[model samples]
Target: MDVQAVLKLADELVFAKTGKHLEYLEEAILRGTIQGQKYSQIAEDFHLSEGHIRDVACELWKILSDVLEENVSKANVRYILERAKFYNFSTIGNDNLTINNVNICPQTPQSPQVTQQPQETSTQPHIDLGDAPEIFRFYDRTSQLTTLENWIICDRTRLIALLGISGIGKTTLSLRLIEQIKTHFDYIIYRSLRFSPTLNATLTNLLQIFPQQADIPQNIETQISQLLNYLRQYRCLIIIDDVQMLFCSGQLAGQYKTGYEDYQLFFKLIAEVNHNSCLFINSWEKPREIAKLEVNNNYVRTLVLGSLGLAAKEILKDRKLSDEEAWETLIDTYQGNPLWLELTASTIQDLFGGSVSDFLQCDAPILDESLQAQLDQQFQRLTQQELAVMIQLAKESEPVALPDILKILQLSVSNLVNAIRSLVIRLLVEVKEEGKTTFFSLNTVMKEYVKNRYMR
Candidate 1:
């Protein structure tokens, strides 16, 4: 078949499988592959990063492999598509046309046999969203949503860590994710560890969601084994929120609080073991094991959420704030956190008569009582070294390089490095990359809070 015919048939096959046409990058990768070009060549031609090109190609290949019932890769994608196209076109007039054993008819837009249907009696996927807060106004997380859907549905990632600071909306994003991908799993469960539930108790609560599980296991090991068995037997999506509550306060990030150490082993199993289920951990600070697991394993990953960018404007608009031209200034000062914006907007209404410009006229960013309390919880969790780093960063008017920080604090390199790393994990410090060097600084709200509370 010619190149156009190959591309058309490939798009059809992909649409038949995923219910969507090929995306721009996917089409680029396919076209490049058909012309026998390397990924680096494709990247250079399209003015994109080679790593991003390869990642898109990998996901595209996996999709085609599932549709064609064969291993599809950059090396053999053209051949596979040509073969499938030839078979499909030749059998168009037959009573039954099949591509890779999946029945399809080229005359129709959607094939009856290829469309996925619920197997069980209930048409809806089983969902147990216990205590998941309702997301009334979701801002633009389109890119994040797509990345997570690809990871969970396409890549089948077993374990994922959704991390961010307080008020950054980790819980909100996860809730929205459930709404988007709930149809793909047999069971979905969301639980909060805010109360610091024991591992056994958490396992029991989750197991109780399944049918035919009235009797609870007495042993912790048995409970874990049974949970794993259920995970392997059915496709499940489990989300645990407030994971930072399980860590000890006044220590480096990720140190488990007393009696919460077993959770480390449980999370490790979720990442290391073979299972169809995905366990998503949403926390202010990631578990220590995640750092090691994600480096060596493709199925394990962490997504550290940053600002909402232009989406923060929606929050301000909803609050009915004035000074449309100065909205970006307020958003930047608060670092685009939704809760922070909401609290600051309320302050503007109460004190500044809904004027953002007036709020900016202050000598420094204002941290109201509620905002300070939210930040207090985060700062109280820092170790002495982390606090020292924060104090130094708060004193700087611009982002400071690592060498300057080391010289200013007179700290051993290792100690300073670990403190900065932990602070980053906790999302307390902001990092800026300039060529080969990295600079660290605090946002306006953080700096003001530090100056008021610690550097007094």
Candidate 2:
């Protein structure tokens, strides 16, 4: 269902008759219609004003209508071309008409026409998932994988959270899962929020994919409604990676950047409102709205990824590291984090003659230079209160109670509450509920890194 090819043929025909090739802006506007995108979106992408874009579009449509001897506009352009027939040219000598089936000549005035011809086979599930990287290999996550599958297919979950710290295989697992369940979806779009694209930009790109809807609105609320309409109309699976980017750095968890706060209402609607489609977010931290809406329902589910166990040994075996006895200790010491293991295993192979025993004997410090650098990227975003809480947690062998932490740090109740909540949301601190009392502690990797370096 790619309209790019059809539009290219039409453009060639246009050039042959008018000596004037379609201008860059004109071409972009046409392409937007084919992809079912809105003018506001097209304008925003090209840095053109809304009024100016429409003016250009009107002129462009007039030119196309005259060139094709048919009614041509952004709305009916794709419909007309889909049903039109192409033929060899004899009208202009030496001007071969190899390209056909492009022009807006719909018969009815009631509504846009749907061609009787069946749509072409699926093309990479509607979104720009074509550039997605290969998973290479996946370890034992059969139980977790099955749970997610059931959640999407059987339980009809509209919102699913794949939450874990970096390098726990969140992205890889998503890629693998989509490949398996793509058959069930009418449109599957995968977008990365790593760059923190605005809700407007994200929706603009999204609307274009579901080309059935021609004119999306300029208003943000309208845009959300338009998306919801599509979700109800089509069984779409939208997967957004690196969703934590939407959260404001140096603030408590779930606080979005100023302009991005609309995403909270957006997520709330997606969870509470009914729609056939589902959204899967792979993030280090859950957005504030999600934390509130995450009730124990089949419709909303969250999966937290932990370390990979025995299967990680396969990595050691392939790396040709010696001493099976030391592998478990190494895995446990580092918490079997896939990325950490990959980095450390390679480092050991290069530096320690592939001897797990030698690496264990040194046991110098768990956070190597590379691993620390990775952790630093996330740690740099933490606030002063959050850092203070981490230091307090590192002092305890057992999880410390809230009152004990407040006393030890001699902090205000308000500061302690905000810091603990933020730290927990950021996945820096783990919490345990012991009857009426609550406890907090840092993970081995964080405790070791903060203690040796900052605590020193």
Top candidate when judged by lDDT against the true structure: 1
Off by over 4 Å in 1: 1-122
What TM-score would each prediction reach against the true structure? 0.79, 0.70
Q: Which stretches of candidate 2 lie over 4 Å from their true place?
A: 1-127, 296-298
Q: Weakest 10 consecutive residues, lDDT, candidate 2?
A: 109-118
Q: Candidate 2, overall lDDT?
A: 0.74
Top candidate, metric TM-score = 1
- For candidate 2, write residues 1-456 as lDDT tens digits: 646666665565556444456788878888887888898999899988876676677656644444444446566777765543234222223334432332222222112212211121345555457446667887777667777876675455789999988887899888888877776677888888888989998887778777754676778898888998888777788988888899877877767888998888888888877677789999888786777787644467888888888778887887899999989988887777888888889888899999888987975445778898878877777888888888888888999998898888867999999989888877778889989998888878888888876789
Worst 10 residues of 1 by lDDT: 113-122
Cα RMSD for predicted model 2: 17.8
Going through the candidates in order, what is the number of backbone clashes in each? 0, 0
Q: Rate residue 95 of model 1 by lDDT.
A: 46
